[model samples]
Target: MDLLTARIDLDAIAHNTRVLKQRAGDARLMCVVKADAYNHGAQRVVPVMDASGADAFGVATLAEGASISELTAKPVAAWLWVPGQEIPPGVELGVPTLDHLSWLIDARVNAPLHIKVDTGMHRSGLRESDWEAAFRMAARAGLEVKGLMSHLAVADDPANPYTDAQADAFRRAVALARQVGLEVPVNHLANSPALLSRPDLAFDQVRAGVGLYGLEPIAGGGSDLRPAMSWVARVLAVKPLSVGEAVSYGLTWAAPDNGFVAVVTAGYADGVARSWQGCLDVAIGAHRYPQVGRVCMDQFIVWLGDNDAGVAIGDEAVIFGAGGVGATELADRVGTINYEIVCAPTGRTVRTYTGGTGA
Candidate 1:
């Protein structure tokens, strides 16, 4: 095992999915496995996901959809940010592609296709008037209208009124698609936050990404889902520091008093953000130590204050996950979001999957 490693709780993932399914109630879930399952290792985590009764899987790219098919041979549906020209392999393996009206005819695969509407999130999808044409083209191209979906820009913010408006727009698009003679079986427009905060947006299928990982995207974080990823690193060295001594770069942090400081083997290069300087804290055994300086490429120092002895070289310092610190907590401390925390981890770090309730 590497000194710095990410422990993936496979059982926690299964548990989280089951919890989300329950919360979603009547809504079918297309588990968003995009960004490599939010950096939890999509390929490695799919078995547990399958065992947990996932209705379907969603990814951001066709490559990811292909990866999903390769891993489980399960029905994988993907919403690509790019247009139709960038489609990848394995489209015949029951993976659905999503795009705007212009690219509707480009989805030449045998599987059903989805039409993405730009409801409010100005990122992807077709405009309102173009949606009907898009569905018409897809139907003519022999593509089954699996669903009509859109992304929410501010579903996590309860105060944001745009959520309802977006839901309404999605409904109108579905109505238009059905008018065009397409079987608009599923209509989805909810991400993790929307799924958690707005029950009304739970259409036929809800796409959840962050919630499955157990980090609340909504305000004042805490969700019904359990955390599935835990990052741990070893304390490589411990040094005695005087009150006036500064730590890391630019002298950003100074010891409060004479105490021991432990240098951890992981840093920004390992996904600990640079903004974590002097603000982040890690748990070693039962004690919490403050991050004392700017996170370096591969290392950071934690101020031990006046305590010592229990924490030594090789002692595990937990960054986030079950039986550990929360990513939401770290993101809040660093003035970022849970999504950044989930993606910040570098690929070099070793991952160990701890099988939970499922085999």
Candidate 2:
């Protein structure tokens, strides 16, 4: 085992996917595999995701789609963030926001795709009026409307009315498509949060991204999902510090009393963000350790106790895992999303994949 390595629980991936599969039912669960399966190693996780019952995979770029396509026989939908006049050859396309009909016409040789509707997210997808038009245009262009979908702008917010509104808009759009005689086979809308919290939105299919990894989007709670990634680094060096001695760069953290500071063998260069600052926490056995001072490019110090508890050099330090310390919580500490946290593992860390509980 390397000093710094990311332990990916392959079985947790399967478990989460099974939960998602149950929620999604016969509609098929589309596991969003963009950004290297949220940095859990798409190459490593796709096969397990396939075995866990993911009917299809969704990617942000054509390259990502191709990369995932090689791993599974299931259909790969390439979701394009930016519109181009032509679709890439040999890959199925997923348009983020269905804008123009001509774009689909230009990609005549590729497979069909699902349309992204900006129900209330205001990020992508076709407008309410354009929804029906886009579907008709896609069919006219010989593009099969594999799915009609929209995104929940605030599915994580239980009190937010936007989720309900998005659902209404999505249903309206689907009705309009059916009225126009378009074969809208699958109608999906909702991400991890929606899939977990708003089960009713699991229409014909639901895109499970973070939830498939067992992390709830909302801070407080949600459905049963197991986090599939665990980050661990070994304590490299331990040093005694006098009271009032500041640590790391910027002199941000000062020891109030005599204590020990242990330098961990990982840092921003390893994808542990410098912004983690005073926010992140690491663990040894059952004790919690605070990250002291500013996180450097390749190193960060943790405030071990003055009493030399049980942590020692070469002792494994768990950044997050099990009972609460998870990728989702790590992201929350720095005010980011779960996807960022999962993918934050620097390339330097050896990725060891295993199948079991407690990823």
- Point out where model 2 deviates above 4 Å: 81-90, 96-100, 322-324, 356-359
Give all candidate RMSDs, comma-separated.
2.8, 2.6
| Candidate 2 least-lDDT 10 residues | 81-90
Number of clashing residue pairs in every model? 0, 5
Candidate 2, TM-score vs. the true structure? 0.91
Tens digit per residue, CA lDDT, model 1, 1-359: 48788888887788888888887889887788888899988877877777776788888777788788887755677765454455555442222233444354554455566667888777767778677667777667767767877889988888888888888888898888888888878778888888888888898988878878777768776576777778888889988899989988788778878998999889877888777776677888887878877889898998887765467888888877655668888777778888888787784578888775444
Each model's lDDT: 0.77, 0.78
Task: Tell me the deviation in Å of residue 59 in model 1.
Answer: 0.5
Regions more than 4 Å wrong, model 1: 81-108, 357-359
- Residues 249-330, model 2: lDDT tens digits: 8998899899888888888899888878887788876777888898987788999867457677897888777533777777
Model 1 lDDT-worst window of ten: 92-101
